[model samples]
Target: MRMLINVPETVVADGLRGLAAAHPDLTVDVENRVIVRRDAPVAGQVALVSGGGSGHEPLHGGFVGPGMLSAACPGEVFTSPVPDQMARAAAAVDSGAGVLFIVKNYTGDVLNFDMAAELAEDEGVQVAKVLVNDDVAVTDSLYTAGRRGTGATLFVEKIAGAAAAEGQPLERVESIGRQVNENSRSFGVALSACTTPAKGSPTFELPDGELELGIGIHGEPGRERRPMMTSGEIADFAVNAIVEDMPPRNPVLALVNGMGATPLLELYGFNAEVQRALRERGVAVARTLVGNYVTSLDMAGASVTLCQADEELLRLWDAPVKTPALRWGM
Candidate 1:
């Protein structure tokens, strides 16, 4: 309830306005909350579109640029964007080459994006979809709903965007996206809950000196809660979960992502701990990225993502990217 804002109801709109102003190379559809690269469709390249709830900034929207997503639809805070919004984004970004939808494995996201894909197909636009379910905390198999997609979605965006930017066909880009999802795993812990602007209060209450382990991005109840532990212990818990699920046989791309309120210093400290844990497990770290790449509003938490990398995956990882949030080798 203690937030600073002139008009709370206008938070999403205001934030989008600011984002559009800050990045003129990107165009914002204020009505639909869809962000598209100013020069969209990129001619013959496969158009990439990914989206979800809004609070996780620098995600689908911040990632719209030359080597990332072609368009991103922002939903209401912590809620999935509706089907119409996604359909509009797909239509706007589709070129003759086709479009790819990178959907996280959230119930709302899956349902809405699926509807959009069906609508897009009816419009005669070729579309391919990949569902990311890389969170190891949730069990997955033929019967289960599959793991919740967390930090790995960012990796999918970066690598898949690179493939599409390289003029890969829609099928190839979709394949790359699926491959990334299949190889990646993530786990998270929350020290504190986040407050949604719309709700104007914390989503959940965590007592002092306690934390929630195996937390999902939507503030969903985690697997367990226990007294606060050292950074190393927390890192071990998360890394061990991922390592247990995905054995250390291949080189890995590591991402230590902050879930909003955690500072850079804390994230780096946690990253060091994660690196130590990986070293102990004999896992070779091919690349490490630490930042607020994927977040859960102001939640004081972090998630670790490991993408088991082969030579081809590593090559794609090194491919040039020019998104507003993730820019390298422009």
Candidate 2:
């Protein structure tokens, strides 16, 4: 894997510096590993904070800005950020309206965010938390006690951040964020294993003719492996698992997310199959986003996340948002 990083030890910091240079609106704290909206501590508005491992670019960090995350703490690659990092973010962004921590269900993230909440509360910052365990691919994985968080983290952050931006109180923001999590489900397929900067090689050995179904972001073991399938075949397998687990009750917000290395051309093709599969299952889509929002670094695959949305949720989802990676309705 010929990654452009200078060295394994400096990859996260290097990326943070680049992010800061690119988005002057965000106050990227390279030393502390926290990213904050420059206009944060917005008076009378609840603050939204979320984070996870660093390899998943444009995730917690890139999503920081208006109508999304007020702050984000980035951990080392495939590692959880320390409690101090998250606590720093909470304190920096909290304007007395409280902070809502959108945590993924990974064991390390869960534990560290839990401690960060306590740390932030000790500093007189009220905090609430919502867990995103939307990956229906597996009940338990190497990284999580429950289903691992994946694409739906984007949905939770965007929807809840919109509510928070409108001055919704902590309780209300927490309610909507959790509702997004509960109403969403994700399933991923891996065409190739991801490579870590430190390892300088693929994290897992995925042979040439096989693909992992229900693959996790960190390359954790999934349901099973099978002979490589076509785009349509992959869509049927993934969509079947998702709808079978939780049939959509309303029009859904669909996320056809790439697993880092998959190109936009391939993602759009896969999305067509996904849409066909959903229609076959009688599911309606209110909105569809196709790209690498939540990702596994350099993994050649994609995940489909369906978020069942009510009218209110759709409105929030359509709200204006400005961020490094995703922006619309400015």
lDDT of each: 0.88, 0.94
What digit string (tens of lDDT, one per residue) describes model 1 on residues 207-297?
9899999888877778789999999999899989998888877799999999999999999999999999999989999999999988988
- Model 1 score (lDDT): 0.88
Q: After superposition, how far is residue 225 of candidate 2 from its true place, in Å?
A: 0.5
Task: Name the TM-score of candidate 1.
Answer: 0.96
Poorly placed runs, candidate 1 (over 4 Å): 139-144
lDDT string for model 2 (1-330, tens) is 678879899999999999999999999999999999999999999999999998898898989999999999999999999999999999999999999999999999999999999999999999999999999899987888988989999999999999999999999999999999999999999999999998888988999999999999998888999999999999999999999999779799999999999999999999999999999889999999999989888999999999999999999999999999889999
After the best TM-score superposition of candidate 2, give how far the Cα of residue 65 lies from its true spot, in angstroms. 0.4
The per-residue C-alpha lDDT of model 1 at residue 15 equals: 81
For candidate 2, the TM-score is 0.99
